[model samples]
Target: MKILLANPRGFCAGVNMAIQCLEECVRMFGDNIHVYHEIVHNKYVVERFTKLGVRFVDEVSDVPEGAILVYSAHGVSPAIRQQARDRKLQTIDATCPLVTKVHMEAIRYARQGYNIVLIGHEGHDEVVGTMGEAPESITLVDTPEDVEKLSFAPDAKLAYLTQTTLSVEEAGRLIAKLKERYPQIESPPKEDICYATTNRQHAVAQLTERADVVLVLGSQNSSNSQRLKEIAKSLGRPAYLIDGAGEIQEDWFTEDNNVLITAGASAPEVVVQEVVNYLKTTFNAELEEVVTREEHVTFPLPKELRQLQLSN
Candidate 1:
């Protein structure tokens, strides 16, 4: 058996920054930190932090007044920030810059009086936050069918943006549909899908071609991770999204199969190595890493965290 491991997989720059922000908070505050959401969507990461006394809460009210709160890599709505401020919580914004870019575009389009269409999965944290930027102007749509139902006049001033973690092919299809329906609809000044998402998806798509079965290491709620699994399945390969090595089922693989393993943007490399170790021990698999792209992107820690570091 052979293993085709994917390069450019696992924690992206934004995830790294967010995780670091949380780690610094824990170290400085001694584990009494409150996170607005899972710092990133990986279950292992969240569970590890929980073990260290970090608390994850969905609402601002859940956090004690004047406590330290870190926003997740997925940005939050302005209302959530206001609530934090109202309670005097010392907040660190760990929102990925790419996600923040979409929020800015939503605000800009709304201020310009353009009816905005946001291409993203409804109810996703990132999508919800971007829509909240200009809820009165932005309408969320994820499918061609959703586009078909839109009743905007063809000549009405219109603009579109996308979630930073969308599948490239899926976003392209949706954008095409929007353009087909509204010839004059404007796109974001730049593509809203983050570079990390595009690189990971492209790498997986290439590896899936030669793989008989594909394994994606990511949490179920991770949007980019889900997209990687879907991309493989779309190519007629058997793909499973697993959180770690323990989720692997022997029945899914055969001695003759070539397996491809990749991790999501928020997944840890340690989880990938665990899966690789399991495969090597069980199947004596020969590992080959397929590199589709090289990434060197880095994001700085959130300003609030940096200031806290400086004061300390």
Candidate 2:
């Protein structure tokens, strides 16, 4: 069996920055760190951090007063920031700059009196936070069918933004529907989907064609990871999303079938390698890497961590 690995599979810039922030916080301030969310939506990553004494909380109110808190890479609303401040928590923002950009766009459009339509899953951390920016002004839509269900007037000034992790093709179709309904709908100054998502999806789209089955290494809660599996399944390939190699099943593979593997932005490469090793040792699979694009993007550590390092 031949195994095709997707390049740029794991650990995108935002995930790198977020993990770095948590590591730095641990190194600088000790193990009593609190994060607002799962950090980057990978179970393995979260468990590793949990073992290191990081606390993940669903609400700012759960954090003890004056505790050191790190925001997740998914970003948070201004209200959450204010809540943290109100508690006098020492805050380190690990929000991906790209996610922050979408929040900024949402806020800007809201201020300009344009009804904002954010395209993303309704309960997703990123979508929830972005919508919190202007709940009164922002309307959330998950699909093109949702766009048709919207009850906006013909002359309403409108703008649209998207979750950074959405499928590029899916977002395009939804945007097309929006345009058809509201001819003057404003778009973000730039594409809202981040580069990492686009590149990974492109790799899967190209590699899935040649494989009988595909495996995506990421947690079930990860939006980007789930999208990778969905993309492969949409292409008529059997795809599985697993947290790591341990989740792989013998029945999912057959001696005659070639497999494709990719990982989500938050997944570690070590996990991907584990899956590869299993295939090699078990099936004697020949390995090939499929690279659709090269990524050189890197995000800086959060400001507080930078200042602490400078002081030390």
Judged by TM-score, which candidate is best? 1
Candidate 2 per-residue lDDT over residues 1-312, each given as its tens digit: 889999979999999999999998999888889999899999999999999999999999999999999999999988999999999999999999999999999989999999999999989999999999999999999977899899999989999999999999999999999999999999999999999999999999988899999999999998999999999999999999999889889999898898999999999998999999999999998999988899999999988889978998
Model 2 pairs in collision: none
Off by over 4 Å in 2: none
Taken over the whole model, the C-alpha lDDT of each candidate is 0.93, 0.94
Worst 10 residues of 2 by lDDT: 285-294
Kindly list the per-residue Cα lDDT of model 1 for residues 1-312, writing each as its tens digit.
899999999999999999998888899999889998788999999999999999999989999999988999999999999999999998999999998988888998999999999999989999988888889999889999999999998799999999999999999999999998899999987899999999999998888989999999999999999999999999999999999999999999998789999999999999999999999999899999988899999999999888889999
TM-score of each: 0.99, 0.98
Cα lDDT for residue 136, candidate 1: 93
